[model samples]
Target: MNAELEARRVERESSRVISAHARSWQLVSALRVEDFDVAHLGRADQVILDMEDAIDDRLKQQARDHVLEWFAGGGKAWVRVNDVTTPFWSDDLSALAGSPGVLGVMLAKTESAEQVSVTHHRLGGHVPVIPLVESALGIEEATSIARAPGAHRLAFGSGDYRKDTGTANEAVAMAYPRTRLVLASRIGGLTGPIDGPTVGSVHSLLREQSEDAVVLGMTGKLCLDHEQPAVINEEFSPSPADVAWAVDFLEKFEAGGRVIRDGSDKPRLARAELITRRASYFHVDPR
Candidate 1:
């Protein structure tokens, strides 16, 4: 096929994957497999059994064992394996090769499209991979990573990126990287990128962060703890007011262009359509 046809085909497939994940605002609250049933699973839109940042080097083998046991018992989740440069990453991929329960792998500290490709190849191409960009270099390569062969989507690893670059933990300080990932997702025809967790237990902070993420075009948020998932899901969802406005706007805009074009936002109308579609698909009753 020509390049245009190939690009269209990829975009179509990416859209399919993104739509599947549209409602999964909260995902894989990274937790040890030992605590899987007791905590992480079923609490969020999705769960990620994190073996990378959550596990210490000494506990790597033990954590891997627990993860394997969980999968053996028919459990399912995305696993956040260590970075590609680490020895643990090779082992992590090896363990995941024939595992039945891994929905995907969230490759931490991903810095290139090549790493994303190798990850899929190493796992034998059985599952989709979401590259978790965590460093300055990773953010620089965000667009390429998003467009990579195995990348289902890109996720921001805000804390690590901040630490690596000596930037503050606040949203404003991180806006550059955040916006980069967002634009990269769009440019690469991938899903809206996943935002980093809002760290603290403050409810207001969580809402503010999730709302900020929504405004910046993220479809999902990574949850760091149990209390975060509910708040993230609700905040990421379309508000009653938004749904009502979307319903009203769609009716007016569909009637004709001349009546609504004065001082109205064309781009916002498209966003309204998405809000309405999501609300309808999720059976949300707008007031």
Candidate 2:
């Protein structure tokens, strides 16, 4: 690569590091190789090549080939593989193992810890395995899946989850599952869990749903549209006001010799510290 091209590649590689706490996880279908432009990742902190439900069964092999070819050409992304129950899961693993640019794998419809462990082991136990919990049974078993030996993080598949439970997509209806994932992530020592995607093109609706995820303690969200990442990143990030408050609070706490004056002090200190850390990591400046 030329100097300019090498510099751009380095920048995108840095973005992938931030993706460890990525707010917007954008999904590009493996069937659409034309969309994998690193220059046009928009505000997505991470990109995922989906090889599961998004691709037709008849074209599964074709999609897999496209993903591998992209890897060969120096493209980097996480792969959302087929569920362990499917025959295609093995094929997905076979193609992904030792593949350059395979950042990690997201296991679809994950229902058990064993599935996560197996997938991680299949990839030689080095690649991270993020489990997408979509079914009612999966929700019930979420903590185990989160604590599983090879499990990296958890993501909610809200659309399929609602279908499994016959529930509405409203926040009130989905609150329980969202909270379950959040608590499970904490218990499992993983970063905050990723929430499901909002299913509309309306920016207002997308913002509303992303804010709802924040309120429910989800730190990241799956995004379907390229336009959705900017909005999702904004909502998931600590706002300037939040950073300002945290900075001021920490200064005052330090001035007071870090003494706790009331029951609220400890929680406030924790919150402030968390906000400051996230602001620093996300490159948010206090306004």
Candidate 3:
């Protein structure tokens, strides 16, 4: 009976993934306007509006208005405010949180859970706080940060983190921090501990960076351009080919009570690991 139930569950999940994959492709195909164009105002899955240096009230109001408009039109918007301890932080939070379209604040350079909790309390618990782990200290304290009140997600700031740690090459320098955020988010049951943005123009390089992020268990990425969205989405979304391959791999591996490989025959049985990848397409492609 248990085996029969398990088989049914697998069948249901596979069907769902296939349907979601089709929907994801449809969305990508339907993207008609450039990301910077007004017509494409809210097409992005997630947009980070930064207000780090906006000291003028008028400029801050304009920034808030722009973000609110983006959110109201259908995009998820997060404000990357100035440092929490800075003078600009309070006004930025008040303006953004009061705006109808803003969903949350991306607390830049978060050092502790206490900072997030306090900010949440100030926001009246109406908005989510996504902590940006941008320092060696932040990475070291990631688990607590994930558990902070109103912290729905954690995002790594690769550039800032590298600067803070005085390291180069994310592949080698940020490996431990990336892994730490992923594991911490998993243990804390958060939606994502997002990988940071790629800092290059080469499409292949960005794709490789995204692939490395996936290997490190990040749920999504921070993209600087719309073109990067497709690569990130494709990496996170399970293709029809992937679904078919997984089904075959699982059947063979379980039948033989051993690991099975693809047509290339290279021992690739990791059925459980495919669950999130397969489900990712059901929601917006977070890039």
Per-residue alpha-carbon lDDT of candidate 3 for residues 242-274, written as tens digits (9 for 90 to 100): 666666666766688555434544435444346
TM-score of 1: 0.87
Tell me, by TM-score, which candidate is best: 2
Instruction: Single out the weakest 10-residue window by summed lDDT for candidate 2.
Output: 35-44
lDDT of 1 by residue, 1-287 (tens): 25664465344434322324543433332444445754333336666777888567888887788788877765666788889899999999998897988878899999999999999999987678999999999999999999988789889998899899999877788789989999999998887888887778899988898888888888888877677877876777788888998888888788875536644576778878899877765556679
Error of 3 at 3 (Å): 54
Off by over 4 Å in 2: 1-7, 38-40, 257-259
Q: Which residue pairs overlap in candidate 1's backbone?
A: 28-47, 28-48
- Candidate 3, poorest ten consecutive residues by summed lDDT: 23-32
lDDT of each residue in 164-193, candidate 2, tens digit only: 999998989999999999999999999899
Taking all chains together, each candidate's TM-score versus the true structure is 0.87, 0.95, 0.72
- lDDT of each model, Cα atoms only? 0.78, 0.88, 0.64
Ordered from best to worst lDDT, the candidate numbers read 2, 1, 3
Considering only N, C-alpha and C atoms within 3 Å, which residue pairs clash in candidate 3? none
Q: Please list the residue runs of candidate 1 whose C-alpha ends up more than 4 Å from where it truly belongs after superposition.
A: 1-31, 257-259, 262-265
